[model samples]
Target: MIEKRAAQRHRVFKGGTITFENGGIACIVRNVSEGGAAIDLDAPVTLPQSFTLAIARDNLVRNCRPVWRSDRRVGLAFVQ
Candidate 1:
């Protein structure tokens, strides 16, 4: 089996919104960093190729893409 390199990670938790082309949704952030973030979403939600994250704290809004996903979680990579 091929091994995937683990990315540099930082643990963070916050509330954010995920807006798809079809509609908008909400999720809880499991972890985050300048480059990417992991979010725990309820059910299997279809994610946009790209989406915006509205971080509740500083109101830092950033755009990211879905890099990986599971039944209840997704990994997003911040777009440069």
Candidate 2:
């Protein structure tokens, strides 16, 4: 199979926050790459098309847009 991702993702286990207007949720970052990251949510919940993802331990924050989702996992594409 062909890999369509722009960058290779590395496995990760880090805490992250999915933040948007007056709201936020705790998430576990499962994988990361230059292009984007995959996060594990506590449960399935609606999220805005665009939001901020903060990884406190790394002191990194970036805007993200959802690319795909599962019951508890969300794939995000970093936006400039």
Candidate 3:
């Protein structure tokens, strides 16, 4: 396999939330970079194309869009 990421991802294990109009879902950030993040969810749920990723402990919130998904994990790209 070849590396295709624009930026290098750093491993992380932080609790966070995925927020949208209706409500929010709890998740764990597995990895992160300036451009995107990998989040681990509790279950397989329908997520919007765009949403907010709030990492309160880090005092950070990023607007994001889903780039990929698996059973309980999602890859997100930060939206400008």
lDDT of 2 by residue, 1-80 (tens): 99988899999999999899989999999999998999999999999999999999999999999999998999999999
lDDT of 1 by residue, 1-80 (tens): 76453566767777888876678788899887778889998778777689887777858787899989888999888886
Identify the superior model by TM-score, candidate 2 or candidate 3. Answer: 3
lDDT of 3 by residue, 10-54 (tens): 999999999999999999999999999999999899998899999
Q: In candidate 2, which residue pairs clash? A: none
Off by over 4 Å in 1: 1-7
TM-score, structure 1 vs. true: 0.81
Give the TM-score of each candidate. 0.81, 0.95, 0.96
**TM-score for candidate 2, residues paired by index:** 0.95
Error of 2 at 70 (Å): 1.1
**Cα lDDT, all candidates:** 0.82, 0.96, 0.96
- Maximum-TM-score candidate: 3
Number of residue pairs clashing in candidate 1, backbone atoms closer than 3 angstroms, sequence gap of 3 or more or interchain: 0
For candidate 1, which ten residues in a row score worst on lDDT? Answer: 1-10
> Which of the numbered candidates is closest to the native, going by highest lDDT?
3
Q: Which ten residues in a row have the lowest lDDT in candidate 3?
A: 41-50
